[model samples]
Target: MPAESEFTVTPYSVDGNVDYEQLLNQFGADKLTADQRKRFPDPTHPLVRREVFYAERNLDPFLAAANSGDDHALVTGRGPSGPMHIGHIFPFYFARYLQRAAGTTVYIPFSDDEKYLLKDQSIESISDHTRENLRDLLAVGFDPKRTRIVVDSADADVVYPVASALGKEITQATVDATYGDPENVGLSFYPAVQATHLLLPQLVEGRQPTLVPIAVDQDPHVRVCRDVAGKERHDVEKPGALLSKFLPSLDGPGKMSSSDDTPSILLSDDRETIREKIQTHAYSGGQTSVAKHREQGGNPDVDVAYLLLYYFFEKDDQRVQRLAQEYRDGSLLTGELKQLAAATIADFLEGHQQRREQLGPLHTELQPYRLTDEERRQALQTIGYPDDSLARQDSE
Candidate 1:
């Protein structure tokens, strides 16, 4: 493991090589136990079974609820700063897997407002990204009836009021400690909005277990929200967390960034573009020369191509192991490995792009997935803002 000083992780920034185990220790999250793994639905998602999603905070309740056919939910969100990238889609896909296997309710929130506050970009730019991101999210094939997509700016009718209520529960000190000193008041107040996202399912559907499947870097957000839920003033339990390691960027390990100097394999990338990006940019763990690589096997553990396949692109367990073994034993050359990953990723993108193409205009396709009026009312009422009062005020 790298020394503690070698890495830095936070909600807004991640630098250097991350030590996931160290992160779990630092974050006070428990590693998923052996029994916890078995408790997951059969044909477990690669993220879970393979230990990509490796740690948790109070996961048992969610699992118990899932097992007993009780209401349970998964909250995984996005910040639409730009077009969606391959790294951006993992949690949604994982949520979809659980939704399919165990009837899990999925709530996807797009924090467009937060992005606008963080980036030096106009509202129009953020809005454009939000539309594009929503299309990609819709293509993930979540069940419209079982899923709700909340865009912060678009759904403020429900989001803002609840966030205003919850905002009282979070201290500015807590926000400062969690996210560092905010550049703007909007960011300082954003934690309330984030907590609102985590607790929304329970607020609307009545209190049950909700799990936030998010990257480990974002654990502080969950911690802050969990603290708010712990307060007795709210009639809600602390939302649990399923924390995952950062998806490796093509250039090397560390969180994949849309604005990175190196290119990310975007969800919209075509076959040729994906192939070119992987070939040109993916960091290789093999020897400098082909002859040297053949003489001394490559290390797939650190190879970007192998890591991508292992992480998501290649799903077959036996095949993944075989490829790793070949690379380790000098039988698989670096070029050959990159080619295989490119093709597999290209194939995956083809399907995602096709679904994206099939989508109607953003608002029309996003309609069924929006919160129902009753849902909005229930959420507001639960958060201490009765809809009748708002209605009365509007009439007055």
Candidate 2:
């Protein structure tokens, strides 16, 4: 771990000991206050309740819309760079909770184009990953009527035109400042595309408060979109953000990454694989010797096994507290905690995998979730293409 103040966090990478509170200051986001939490529909998701999702910018309008049963939506996206992992699924599940609780419309965008530009991969490779990723996303069980999944390349009819309009508002200097200099022109243009993703819900459904729930590292993307929405030309409210800490990696405390030497628990891991991985690779907070651990109480705060449960797997608050206490006093052995987390995580994945298996052909299952022709037209029209504005003129 780097020194307390030595960390670096950006939309692309995170390193060292991240001071999350300091990040809020650096990013100009506020803490997710108690008053704001109170306004959420009953049975708030543990991600929010446990402060796993701990910060915000412009959250109230969305909350007001949620409470009053008015129009509201959430945009949570995926980058199909590789197979989905445990860390990759948090925001999707969190969004599902909001959808169930408040009837919130959900828009999921797969930035395959961004991944292609950023990674040394081909379009075919990205497409393969996109199809697999769509399966995992489908397992989360969002309502088809209220949810729309947009793939940047596949949906470019709407995405490209909308992004082109917003691109005029976002300068190269702004993109350079927010994300650093572009490695490629596609990346330079991606911030505008990202703004298109965030604002698309309102663009299609008419102006409504939209909330983007994402890890704190992604806040810059939201800030860029908010800046564009503030411009006079776009008829949209700035999307709000609900930011969260990086999910802890299996090896230790820093952000989880597939690039890390320690293998991540993929969404496809079976019960045995999950157990073996947890028992072998999970970082321990206990003493070197069982006797010493019993004598001197372990620190649950840094334990990967315990943190996984606290972060998502264990929903029963009292049980989690009890386990933490037991672990602190050495009543809960580190192996026992690992066993418990492996089982809990396996249970969650069991259902997810079952749903995935039950799903029909990928293209067929994905159909209902794709934007309808009318929706694509509405989105394009909102960005100034009325009835395919140019095509109509050309035909005449």
Candidate 3:
């Protein structure tokens, strides 16, 4: 392990003009009290929260769904637009933590081909990108066997049922209710596939509690899943949902998007790139001038450095606390804080790279696809896939 000191560093004088409190309020961090806020206080918001529901609408249904006592299966799908970044791992880590605590099973899907449609990338690139993304996900410490990984384009049989079931469940009324105006067939189809993935484990022999640790932006899909889960239970019997919040980009509250083309720190980023990005770009909620900062104190609520520390730095709680205190008192400068954050991030990516290297070729080969022919055939017939050879191949 690299010593903590080996990480990159940058220095900046604080300017008091930044409205840290307003920034936090805008991002919904205002819900926390001063002391409670201190635990996370900035960009590093906690992944887990007491109220784990899908959206602001329909709280009662989600609560009722939670009470169903059916085992929860965590589901997440990657677009495979590009390399997996630190932001990509946030929900995965949360799911891993939840699975360990609750002993629940997880289902991860590589929606590589979906990116081709959504991002306008070519379909030809999705297969290789999905494979690469899967390796990155495995390196994040997800167990291959315990977690079922599937590619959307490849597993037509497994995917078709869920898609068909979802289409049946999502009437025009439901589609209009959830997605105002349903303009695209792909929108309905994709949500159905996601809903099917959510319910698949429940149909399997060992039913488990299913939860999807995802960013809040993906809640729409989960809402669709919830709707389908209810219909499936009545029609076919299946499990429901559990959702998590999205991790913000290092730049701040917006989604950590791969297509944006702005510099994002990927798991594959080298030490120098990680350091430069953190030092140069990671948003800081600190002071503009060092003199004013010392007089007025640092704003812990919006500081990017503090946020990264809360999420990434596992040890040195006391040191982190001390940094917060100094920052709040305006004794610590934003430049020094940025340096610390860059270093911490560099260390984390380095460690991740080492673990990723250990995953090897067999791990890639072992990632779950759709069911075999016999299994796919049975499932397809059950779900009503016609005699499509590609679909048959998926069952095989």
Candidate 4:
């Protein structure tokens, strides 16, 4: 953990090292208690069990729904500013896991409009990224019947009106405080769209619990949505959040982390590319030389290769422990550890890549996942819009 003074966690930016415990305090969210952890569908996910997903806000209801086999949902999103990466897609897999374990509906809102407003890019470029990202998302094999993929611009007939209603509750002061000064009004208004994303399932499915599993930096978005959900006129409950720590950057923990500009392992990385990137860039915690490393064992805690495996790539608990112990006891060299992580990552990517290739045309494959016409009308009507007129306009 980095010194408290050095780190900051906000909705839009995370700088320095994150103190997740302190973050729970500052964000006014609860840490995952043993009781709550037990409530998660049997076989708690590694992300939850290992505490990568560390804190939450009002998560009990969602857990209750999962345990009781009642209606519930998981809302994880994508900002298509660039290509999909390993760090970016794990949540979708986790959502799929929950869907299998608890039959939870998933709502994936792709924020192409937000990325276009924030990034220096043309609408054409943003649309291109959205299409590519959509392909990767489709390959995740979510249940099409239970999943709804909403693109902000593409689904504007539904998203825009709901956002317009929610926008009334958000003050400019709150926006500035949460996101700092917005570069433009689109950035200022994007939170309302986000609130719309978080609350849409309830509006459409009838006030069931909604869970947003996301990186903790994105908690502020949940908070804003929760706040909007609190309005008395709305028949919705505040959405819960399952917050996660940042997957470390290749450089190491608290030091270097993944970003758009940073060199990251993409979803489509070939075996050779995966090997080269991990071998060339993975930060090591072993001694300077072989003899020294044998004398002073490597520290898996600071080793990016070990962290990468432990974080998501390696699924077996015993295997990860063995690797850590081996590295710590001088039995595993930095090169060997890097190779192990690289191989694990390469295998995972190869599988995902194969799935990607196996997918059909993007639009046809995505058809089952897109929102239904009735769902759009329901969401609009729930948010105080009379869909009779709006539905006609949309159809026309």
Candidate 5:
């Protein structure tokens, strides 16, 4: 067993006062130094650009820990409310990239069980939704062998132990530090399940580094996981985290929701549907009049079409710079920009659907169960088996 000293935790900071301009300037100066821009180009808009900067900054510690082979873990899951949208792709993709670069183990837990409460959807609906969601996630191009994907319902035996153990470690102080209240049972319990997923990999055979790629809004959950892991209640090293910014809704800067049935595009939408939706519903930050837009140029800051391009399209930096210039100079009309975005998005979705179809079924075979009789025995031995009734039965 690896000693507790094998894991290292590093602190991170984000400059509270650093505005968009300073961020852009820093990005420009540091552009030649790092290969991140080659993989994920600098976003044209200031808001997204700043977000990208912050995401990379936050990931530095996790990246370092991963290189050191410090038994870190990455945790991410979907709400299973409906078909995943394009926005759902960011966190997993970021995780895949970092995991591949650092040779870390990645665990993607299907939070389908949590969807029962969060989405207000029926338990019966969860099975089909979870299967379809897993299919979609597999299609996103993560390595099946390297990643361990588990559905919360069918895998209850595996989940329950980790969840119960972590739950006992949650003090009122820790709960308040996370959700700002110990009364929210749902919040507290959910974090326990999530942390269980993170540390579960360490309890299994061939332990590896765990790093969770998630959005900033989900930071509270990761914080709880880190705290629980650090307490060593689960007898495994604490997992590190990498956080991304939430992908904004097509309607604007507000939440990109599947329940709202708003303008956001789903992964299942066909080419024609995608085109129609973008042309009709996609918000444009340009002027109502062409004349005024030509004189003043469109604001890329709030333009939905431009933001989509930054997220999806891969191009030379010069091309992005030119697009920003053309949009601002009124040379690129809102209609044309929307058409371009729709085309780019349609291509991306079509490719994903094809990949998903090739992934075949979403079953236990793809992501093998983490705990077996032998594996459980080994984990208990590593942690000096607990004295609880359930532990005695499992041990027997």
Candidate 6:
């Protein structure tokens, strides 16, 4: 394993001494507070209560909107470049929970075009992942009326024009600095698409507080979008950001990492498969021998099994703490810890799979969540071309 002492977190890379608090300082985002968490609709999500999502940018407005029964929305996106995994679904679930709790509108944008531009894949290949990812997203069971799932390529009518408007505000220098040199123009222009994704709800329904929940490294995209919203004369509010730490992968403590050798646990894994993966691959912080482990105890901080539960799967805080205490004192074995974590994660997958299996044909189920023609027109018009603003004229 590479030393964790040195790390770098960019829009495209994350490694080494993450130091999330220092990240907050560097990114100019505020740490999430307990009181702010209480403002969530109800039954506060584990991600929030446990501080998995630990920082925010201008969240007071969103909190006020959620609590005051006013207009609010959330933007959580996925880049469809590969298969869906346990780590990819948390934000979608969080968005669903918020929508259910507060009646908040949710916008989920699948950046197929961006993935195509960045990856060594064809557009057709990216489309395949998009369809597969969309299925996983649809299974999250968001309200069709309140949730909008936009495949950027499919929604280009609105996405393109709006992105053009936002693109005007992003300079090549900014793109290079935020994401490094783009291999192509499409990649260079993706920041605008990202901005459009963040601001789409407002463009469609008029200005409202929008919170974008994402990993912290992705903050630069939100920052770029916020800058456009601030600089442009458009009638929009700067989108707020809700940032999270990377979920621990089966391999180790740092964000779920996958190398050529290690593979992530796909959402399609069966219970037995999940158990085998965790037991065989999960990193352990236990002592070398049984006697030594029992005498010296295990380290939960670096134990992938314990971190997995502490991160998301284990809901009962007290129970999680007990597992940690037992591990620390050598009462809990690494195998036992792995079994517990595997079971907890598999239980989550079981419920998710049940919902997924119950899904109807993708196109049919996705229809209600797609942007309406009127919405597309309004979004396009709001950015410019008031001629198509008929859909938004009354809403104005």
Candidate 1 residues lying further than 4 Å off, grouped into runs, are 1-4, 389-396
Candidate 2 has an lDDT of: 0.93
Using TM-score, give the best candidate's number. 2
For 228-266, candidate 3 gives per-residue lDDT tens digits of 766533344433333333344567643455656457888
Off by over 4 Å in 2: 389-396
Candidate 4 weakest ten by summed lDDT = 253-262
Preferred candidate (TM-score higher): 4 or 5: 4
What does candidate 1's lDDT look like per residue over 161-214, in tens digits? Answer: 999999998889988878889999999999999999999999999889999988
lDDT of each: 0.91, 0.93, 0.59, 0.88, 0.63, 0.88
lDDT of 6 by residue, 1-396 (tens): 446545688877786768888888788899998899988877988899888999999998999999889999999999998889888888898898899888999999999888887888898899999998898898888999999999988988888888988889999999998888888988898899999999999999999999999988899999999989997488999999999999887777666643336778888899999999999999998989889999999999989989889887898989999999999999999999999998999999988889889988988999999999888778877887666455567889
lDDT of 4 by residue, 119-176 (tens): 8889999999999999999988899999999999899999999999999999999899
Candidate with maximal lDDT:
2
Rank the candidate models, highest lDDT first: 2, 1, 6, 4, 5, 3
Error of 5 at 303 (Å): 0.6
- lDDT of model 1 at position 259: 84
Comparing 4 with 6 on TM-score, the higher-scoring candidate is 4
TM accuracy, model 6? 0.95
- TM-score of every prediction relative to native: 0.97, 0.98, 0.74, 0.96, 0.78, 0.95
